[model samples]
Target: MNIKQADFVKSAVFERDYPEELEHFEFAFVGRSNVGKSSLINSITNRNKLAKTSKTPGRTQLINYFLVNKEFYFVDLPGYGFAKVPKEMKREWGQTMERYLASPRHKLVFVLLDIRRVPSGEDLDMLEWLDHYGTPFKIIFTKMDKLSNNEKFKALKAIKTKVDFHNDDVFFHSSLNNNGKDEILNYVEACLNGEVE
Candidate 1:
């Protein structure tokens, strides 16, 4: 769908702090700390700073909400598996994300994975958690601009070997060149329209 107006609604860590518009659907974005979740959101929404892009990995510590087209919500769940953060903080982030996922408003989740790196244990665990909970999710392989076509082919093959996923369930995205942006948005539109599962 076309995102004409994307605005930052609020940052929430708990259910009570979320926007009261329960009628609207919610799409959540989640990934490792340095996997470029913010950049992907900005690129998809065509906003430069809709979600903060930071040089530091673990900057987004709270669940951020953005209203898109004044209709639905883009929930930016905090990044996980940042090595430098305290163990307690990491655990808290995991719990916070689980709490949000448990809510009924969450329609779909876009799980971003860096193309240049192998999916970590946390990444695999997140995918398993989504599967176990029966949450609909799409895997996004981000930072496509960093790899050549041949390198990308091999990287994707390597990742597939480690993580069992269907070709239709994944998208390659690049924030710099806007690669796979349209396909991703189209998939979102399909999901919102109940055209695709």
Candidate 2:
């Protein structure tokens, strides 16, 4: 889809604080802290700095929503698995995410994973939780530019061994090169057109 306009709408900490008009479909992005979730969002939307990117992990503490094309939303769920935050704060973020994921308006969720490293225990747990909830999600391997061909192959193999996924369902992305941007945006367009579930 051509993104004529993409803008940050709001930051909601609870279900009641979410946008009152929920008629549009939403695609949510979730991953561990410093997993390039913000970079990927900015890339796909063709807007640099639309979603705040930071050198610090756990910077995104709220459920940030961005209205895309004035039709649907791209929801940036707070990153998980950041240990620097207080335990109580982590619990609050977890609750906020659970409520957002349970919402019916969520059309799909893109689970980002760093291609350079093995999926952490927290990542695996998130995958299992998504499965338990029967949430539809696709895996996106980020930072592909940092990996060699052999490394990429091994990483994908290791990831598949840990989580069941079809080759077609997984996408390799790089924020620096804008890799996989078109495929993601096209997939979003297809979902918008009722071409994909």
On TM-score, the leading prediction is: 1
Residues 125-196, candidate 2, lDDT per residue (tens digit)?
888888898998889989999989998888888887777778787888999999888888888888878888
Q: How many collisions per candidate? A: 0, 0
TM-score of each: 0.95, 0.95
User: What is the per-residue lDDT of model 1 for residues 1-197, given as tens digits with 9 covering 90 to 100?
Assistant: 78899999999888898888646457899999989999999999999999999988988889999988888888899999864889999889888888998877757899999999989999999999999989988899999999999998898889988898877768989999899999998987877777875
In order, candidate lDDTs are: 0.88, 0.88
What is the alpha-carbon lDDT of model 2 when measured against the actual structure?
A: 0.88
Alpha-carbon RMSD to native, per candidate? 1.2, 1.3
Candidate 2 lDDT trough over 10 residues, lowest sum = 16-25
